[model samples]
Target: MLNTACLRIHISARTTTTSRISKLANSASLNTVAARCSHHAAHYDGPSPTIAIIGSGPAGFYTAQKVMRELKGTKVDMYEQLPVPFGLVRFGVAPDHPEVKNCQDTFGDVAASPEYTFIGNVNLGHDLPLPLLAKHYDAIVFAYGASKDRKLGLEGEYKPHIYSARAFVGWYNGLPEYRNLNPDLTAGDTAVVVGQGNVALDVARTLLSKLEHLKKTDITEYAIQALSQSTIRHVHVVGRRGPMQAAFTIKEVRELLQLDDVNFSPIPDELFPNDLKSLPRPRRRLMELLKKGSPPKEGASKSWSLDFLLSPKSLTWSSSDSDKLEGVLFSKTKLEQADSPESKVTNTDETTLIPTSTLFRSIGYKSEAIPGMQELGADFDDQKGTIRHDGIGRVVSLDTREWDKASLYCSGWVKRGPTGVIASTMTDAFQTAEAIVEDWKKTFDSRRPVRAGWKGVQAEAQALNLSLRPVHWSNWQNIDQVEKAVGVERGKPREKFGNVDDMLKASGASG
Candidate 1:
């Protein structure tokens, strides 16, 4: 979905191991950053520019952190639709992966700054007009990650027993939107996951994992109960291409392979290239693992497989019961170049039907432009499922000049497509933050009025009598304390509130 085309209307516009050490090192330099900001504050006499960030996810916080460090006396107001902050960390991330959420500690540090503000329980496009928000800030940063998932576009996709990977993940992770998903995992022992990404692996792993293991994680109590009754044991992770073209990483594959008592179905040796020794280290290792597979445990009751080169053609329903899913119909595909990772795949005449009652589509995630984006001279590329932007992050539209009005920028999945890991997101956010700081410095003028930031937005909302109760940083801290306390009693990290009302009440913003 990378828009490589140089549009005149433009309106607009990572590594794993070394990444972890760099983040830890970055955390230790907070004091130096603060000292540097103080020096900048002492020398600069211009009016402090206020920025409005449209999300409270990793991207928003990281962008805020960098902007505050680079620009002295800057005020950042981060807005979150949910009462709680930390978008993906709180909801999208798997409950078992607590280490991946260490970024929250950095976000916590950013939230502690006096110049930073968190406005939660506020839906931007619905609760407040986008143009009204724009009037209050010198720049607007859109960091809201993807909210929707890509569909398989096959027939019978909307039928029961079929679920998107995004919805399933949300249901297990306690995201309020999908709290009541309650998928019917007891239908059958076999589940077909249609995708080769890490999310597909996550679904397979969760289905195969013991309920007791999931209980120790922050997965909701209801989810744990539902999983306890899951009859799903054999997961077939299907993909449209060969193993070399899989979107999943070695870490995810290894995790699935290491699941206790869950055996892995060895991939066909023909699927991999003969000259594995010449492949890149990561791919070679992954191919080797797929070839080697996990040892069969004596008590193994569950199993999974990495099924490749099969495109989902349609869903098969039970002959006797039209409502019940029977299996998935897949068309066999042939890769143009078996050795190449980017090989094109073509469907062959042969088709295979894998009998299963459940299916999970794990294709990818998608982002949409917030409502009223047109008012700010921004446009959403519906086809691309992203806010149209210059490759760097500056929002572009045919209606507005490049430098006439308040700057509009985007980051993370909204700026680019929804891809990459947390570390990659951090890097993307930092780049956007740099662009913002540079633009602000170049445009700062004595005659220009200082932005009112949140105060202005509050005044506007009051004038309109919107009856909004914005959740502040202190409120979120109270909510955090409550969640953590509950988690302590539950023997888990944190039991997140699964609905907006509960979250609002906990934050004391129910009014």
Candidate 2:
């Protein structure tokens, strides 16, 4: 998950393109997009570029959107590991934030394009080798976002009550990978979430929000049952840095504050600078909100607080219940400059402990190189957890001679080291699309033969006797309809199938 602080900059820079793209998405007409691409078509007499994008998340779809809008007759084959699409929008987003998922509608419109093909349930590295895609497409775009979460690296951090925010979010949102996470919210009444990101806040809020509020969203049924029985009433969002350096946005903080019957504990006045007037607008507003706190509610059984300048040291188990988490040990830290957001901090010998029954680590996300990326001459920066690129989305090939020939590129978190929000991803993806278009036009004479795209890939798979059941766009629609129909029965937005088999069955792809 990324921060939304850079959203305004992206929106302002691409206002015209976005407005037109919005109109095209609303219309969902091939002719409108074709008309927009006519001028570009006149310049390229060669066959339209056939691109294979890995992942069906916002980055992939937005990249496909811009390329398709600019390159007439271009074909994009999107590969997704699951039977369903919309990677993060479907699995990572908090169920309560439905507004953030409006981008899915645009993704749906992108799938409606005849030039776009959604090949779901196809794992490129496992189901089909990465090298095999090169024979069938002119270019490959890696848009798969970070799939791993960062850890606190503290002693006894992998105990039963400890979980990553990713796993918990996936468990509730119906992601197959973490469907069985089954977090024991009933373990105790207090839980500590280690991080100050929006995800940490999401976990805190979910533990405290009214069941009736979550019931109307697309959260899984099993998750709802577990949450209904949750005994958690207090949450401590712990961070290594002070409030000025916290990663959470003002909107998420404000939402948590406004939850009914949920009280927020006030921050110590000394933690903040004496004169807040010197801080930037966003920081000023957030600090003010933290200072003001939430209104007192009568009979408020749930409360949460921000605990800062505490670096996690170890996890303690309960004395009575040895298997259960008792609390987290933290070493106190002091910032070199209290008022500066980017100030460095040094840990002090003094330590404090916050008693708890559960813990969630939401430090950040990390991207790993897909197995067999080396087969395509692609590189991954292990330290940075990002695909090796030229800082502009073009994957840096091991052989410079094969750079232009390989036509390999990347976008989103995998390219930019998992940081910015959806708006930032869109901007990053659009820039990649422009780069591809420019390269295609520049290297037209040396371009490879016209590739058959998915058609060629399907033939190769059949020849290789690979066991693959691809869920096309129509198949996803069937699954979508069934989920929505089931939602109507439950009086909620939608009840996602808990596993891949159910999704495959709903998509009519089950053998």
Candidate 3:
């Protein structure tokens, strides 16, 4: 069990220096007057359009950028529940995939713009009611990405040794919320991870990388220690569907083949349908790699299996005092073509059990509706767990095509129904922003302006008794300084502040 008291909040709050503000104003003055006028006109013309973005993810940041750029003088405030910004980009993407994180630089640029204010460490439903925000801002965009994991819904899933792949990944990646979730790696030599997506591959690879070959990477110190002490020798990655129906991409599949001690087993031709065999060369190469079963020559231990056509039915635990995960019950499955090109799999209903000490399920993600918005007549899809929006991304009531008076919007995984890579999310964000701009144009002069400027907003926020940790540009610079300094102490590239309060204190924002 982890101690919740150890988790600390890092607050970065300090006013910008006079020199910096003056420099920004001076530089901003050089831009064309037409551009400036057009920007501010979107907010001041109708009823001062106060825009609130409920997330700080890629989609939220991109949407904010588009709105600020096109709407000019709009009052846009972005709220993030985390003390730090960048949702999955910071905590979900693997540390090795740093290039994908370049998106953060772009997000940082948007956050720094004068047109926006980043209110970090504020939970939407908890800190401020959604309806209240809607009333305060002309528009509210719920860009909060799916944080919960999909369950296997099997018997005995509540067993202690079982964990959701989402939590495990977050734990290894040093997410403050899940940093202390240390699984007992010493209990068993072998483990099983269910699902066949990029996330599944990531978990498998991270588990396999426990060998000495990957010790140099920037894995969390605690994760590194736990993995180094792991007793497991093999991991079986099980997928219900055949190779052709697998959700994992070619790149991630190939990366798994390169692991030092692991082996990649190629699927037999009989397992794939005739149509799938006729796929283009790139996909053929992926299938070809899936067919070879040669173990690597080096590493701490050998043996990892990729088992297909297996659906987990239950997680069985040992009756002994150890009370550990004893095995998983599964049913064999077969795939059949659907009406469309995508195929679907059905379990034969026959069952078998495989003994294992640990299990991880990585089905998918689901979105939760923000609280207090239901009264405003917000509609949600029960099957998809997504907010129902029209082509322009406006939240709509179930009864009609008209917009809900609350004018709620969404982007990222929540907007497009939890599918796509970061690049796809960027495209979705751009589309949502375009729609918001279009909506603004129609109601530009009709909205009422609130008496709040930056100063008044600051005063109101301060009066709320919220932590005034300013996380100003200088504070970020200080954080960078401390991170680099600590990284040097450990002989790594950069050591992150695992504890949030320590980071704030080191940045001089917390006394």
Candidate 4:
């Protein structure tokens, strides 16, 4: 029924298609076998590498920046649990310190790369098994920061008025997890912070800062209201060490000493190094500043002190109401060797109690393993509270005692532990990026293409019938614009959305 010429042409086209499919399907028999974008990832013969970065914090962004620069054909897919990016910058950083967040500009530049993909609101372990991601990505970098807080194991730590510094900071910065954390700031006139870290100073400063000053920053409206109604008039930043071994940086200490109407109680001279000149330059300067304590300000109604060489013993409750926190009991401690960071402390026979209605523990942060990490041949250090890794950030396998992947890597707090400021985090992240590049080049095959990262993951998720609502970079920008617009009306730099659902809605993504 068909013309001979037309039938012949159709038959030739079909033959060409069959020949091409057979060639592609059997290409593994030739030279290289690579899988990508299939139910398990399809095989390909190209040479570009694909990478997945599992956090949107400063460390993650910095690592991605370095990797992208070093590997021209590398693709980076960043994952975040929050609808927004800039993990700590947006949540952990104090709102008043906008200068520290300048690094977000660099992150913005990195996100703008065509090879970069921002996958926000998709929790790596919660939304999909971590091992499943390993199938798609040639490498996975864990930068999901410390999500838990360290505890002192003291009695009554979970008492009502006692708060962890992490929660307090999150509450003020509008982190969705703590948005509804309505801390009863009006319940106390005196507060005790049981650590001498920078975070402790931040907490103390926020409680003491003038509302007019706070209003100029992007601190949440909710936090502003709670602080404005606060009855706190005294703060004690206590530590189980001397001023010489204090954890606070000089810049933060200076800020506290300079607050407008706040009175600073002088640190004991005995706690400082006797031969100040013999100390390091930074310590010398800090010691000198401490010695020249802020001149007692006239009409200074509120005050704070750097109480040293004391460990928290227990919380004291009101005699009249067992549930009401009345004060804190602390054991006096003596340093094993004074004026040294490594010095240990021993509890003395003496104990002291300071009456107050509130307490904040600023000890430190703890990083825990995601549920599915072990399935990926990676193990979290239960004792250390970190992912098991080489000092340089290569995730390690306990059984094989080798690089967990030659592929799995880590950066930031998850790699090193929760310490240091953003600058330190950037440096560590760069080191991890370099390690990843080094490992990749060492094991790379010229003929084989890297497995598709997000592309393959998308396919797998679809195949598994999982709904993943990812907020891409463009979506985050829309959310940013909305936040800024709202901030303008409130006369603040940028009022953040304190809830996750609202953040997704603003970004035009369904939560």
Better structure of 3 and 4 per lDDT: 4
TM-scores for the candidates: 0.91, 0.91, 0.83, 0.88
- How many clashes in each structure? 7, 0, 21, 5
Could you report the Cα RMSD, in angstroms, for every candidate shown? Answer: 6.1, 5.1, 9.7, 15.9
Candidate 2 Cα misplacement greater than 4 A, ranges: 1-46, 397-405
Indicate the TM-score of model 1. 0.91
Q: Model 1, 1-511: lDDT tens per residue?
A: 1111100000000112233323433443433332332223224455567899999987798789888877878999999998889987777767777766666777888899999999998898888877888767888999998887888887888989999888998898888999888899999999999988777877888888888888888888888888889898899999999988887877778889899989888788888899899998878998998888888888899999989999999888888988799998999999999889889999999999999999998887778878888888887888777888878888853235444356888998798877766655666787888777767776777766668899989998999988787999999998889988999999998888888888878887647
Stretches of candidate 4 exceeding 4 Å from the true structure:
1-46, 397-406, 446-449
* Local distance difference test, candidate 4: 0.79
Please give, for residues 374-479, the per-residue lDDT of candidate 3 as tens digits.
7655676656767778855777532442332335677876776666655445556767777777776764443345534334545665677644454444455577
Q: For candidate 4, lDDT tens digit of each residue in 1-511?
A: 1111110111000011122222333343211111111122233333556888989987798789777766776799999999899987778777777765656777898899999999999987888777788767778899988788878787877878889888999999999999988999877799998888888988999999899999989899999999989999999999988887787766678888999999999987888888989987767998899888899999997899999999988888987888799988889999988978679989998999988899988888778888788888677887667888878888853235332232788998888778765545655787888777766666666544447788888899989988899999999999999999999999998999999888888999754
Q: Local distance difference test, per candidate?
A: 0.80, 0.81, 0.65, 0.79
> What's the true lDDT of residue 282 in model 2?
63
Model 2 lDDT tens row, 290-329: 8888888989999999999999998898778767898889
Considering TM-score, which of the candidate structures 1 and 3 is the better prediction for this target? 1
The alpha-carbon deviation from the true structure for residue 47 of candidate 2, after best TM-score superposition, in angstroms, is: 3.1
- Please identify which of the two predictions, 3 or 4, would achieve the higher TM-score against the true structure: 4
